[model samples]
Target: MRTAICDMLGIELPLLAFSHCRDVVAAVTNAGGFGVLGAVTHTPEQLEHELAWIDEQVGGKPYGVDIIVPEKYEGQGEALSLDDLAARIPPEHHAFVDRLLREHGIDTTDRAELAGRGMNISDRIGERLLDVVFRHPVKLVANALGVPPRYMIDRARAEGVSVAALVGAKEHALRQVEAGVDILVAQGTEAGGHCGEVTTMVLVPEVVEAVKDVREVPVLAAGGIVTGRQMAAAIALGAAGAWTGSVWLTTEEAETAPYTVRKMVAATSRDTVRSRGRTGKPSRQLASAWTRAWDGPDSPGTLPLPLQSLVSEPALRHLDTLAEKGDRGAQELATYWVGQGVGLMNRVRPAKDVVYEIAEDFAEAAERLTGAIGD
Candidate 1:
């Protein structure tokens, strides 16, 4: 459990669990591992409330926050209102979604209210979120999309918070290190959410070697790492530790919809696909009718970042509600961000138990490795 990340983040274990659920964040931190709350979906007001609640639960344990501020996207430098952004989405895209929903036997009629429901991912919003984050006791701040914006790194450094950025390519890792990131999460395509084409086994060592000359920046291997044995493997591959996300989706404290959880449990390594249907980028999720329609041959194609987000979230939100109510079609079209590791996540356990198990498993794997050195 002793590693650079453990010391840097001030935790007993190097296992870092990323979850959107506040309960999971507090539970993992309290159990010894670090928890990073996903804040891209939360508004400033909501983030303040969520952070305050986590502050009360963890009793001073260190934690982190993840925000998506892509380095390049539609309307990056533009000042557009939510209405202005929504207006850019063409009618064909909406019609395509409506047809897809209807094919699944759900009603998408007169749903104009769903139009501006997408999460905003602009510089202005990211700066506002950073302001909220700095006001709290967050020890680490992570960006998953691209290099942490210059202001983000500067502000985090000013506030004495470690800046962590997730990169899939060795080139991206170099960029983050050059940009002064305190830590690097070398994520692979097996990871949930937005990811690149590299595999973890290759990317970890590649990134570690790529940045050694620059400085001794710690790298956490991410993508489909669910078990302590996998965490041990990541360390063997030259990672300081493991950064995990999908594994926590099935934990008891997760807020994943009941039906989607069932689909995930029944899934295997081959069940997920890297489709851009969700956020207009290739994110790994359980393949469903929604993903297939957008990635299919006769489709109009996906939109750019936040613009594509506007079209998808509203419709998916509606389907999720019906899926919870036993609408079989909705369930068939239901999907959530997950990785190939879903095959091993067949059981649901408390977040604390999951954290303890990973730590214990890591120790056992380390002993086994040591024993191999002799005899």
Candidate 2:
């Protein structure tokens, strides 16, 4: 609780809950832990609206915003239209998606209409979102993938907002430190969403040790850390706090689709897999018929970031709709981003209760450790 991250963020607990739901964000912050809104899904206007709503809800509690500005994507430098990117998606990929849907008894007739409607995750959009974020009283701004852009870092510094970067490897951690990130989220493969191959147990200490000489930025251990016991373990491994996502998905205030939330509550850690089927980057998600279809031997390989998203998001969105309507096939195919820690998330509780539980459990874990040392 006395970690540097707590002091820097002005939070009582170092548990940072990342969620797309503003309710969860405000609830966690009011519960004494920091809440960071996942802003990748929001456009500038949407982000502004959400932040305003969060500001009113939290009543002056400090919160953070996370945006995805990946280090690499299909359109890294050159400007490309959504039509251009959609055109580049191989016909085979489309056929595979169409076939996958039809086989599941879901209609794919309006697939094209749904393809590019989702939020575009690019530097251009990120900058616009950042513009909106800087005008607000955000305590932290984090880049979910790759290094935070120099402009973002500089702008956050100028705004007196701390910048954080999520990294899966020690090398990436060092690069972020060199890039002047104020906080490092050492995310392991067990994490949901885009993640690298290393496990948290190994990657956390490796990153902490590797970044010791480069800079002393606060390291938050992420990936499959859903409880205070896990948070205590992360601290034992040299993390200042725990950066959690999956556990929040099951919280009462979470905006996770109802069907998906049911699936998550029923899932075990082994029920998740790391597949590039969703975001075109290796991210741990609930292992479902959808992921299995993409991982099968007959499947076409995945495309990169935005391209992969274009193909998958629309289809998944439709599947979710059908699943909600009680389509068994859609239910089997319904999956969402979640980590291996989902097994422990067996029930839905209020977001505030979750924070208090983590704090209480973390205190007990610390006491047990002290007892072990004969203190």
Q: How many pairs of residues in model 2 come into backbone collision?
A: 0
Scored by CA lDDT, what does every candidate get? 0.90, 0.90
lDDT of 1 by residue, 83-175 (tens): 778888999998898888888888777676455477667658999999899888999999978887889999999999999999999999998
- Candidate 1: C-alpha lDDT: 0.90
Best by TM-score: 1
Off by over 4 Å in 1: 110-116
Question: Could you tell me the TM-score of candidate 1?
Answer: 0.98
The 10-residue segment of model 1 with minimum total lDDT is 108-117
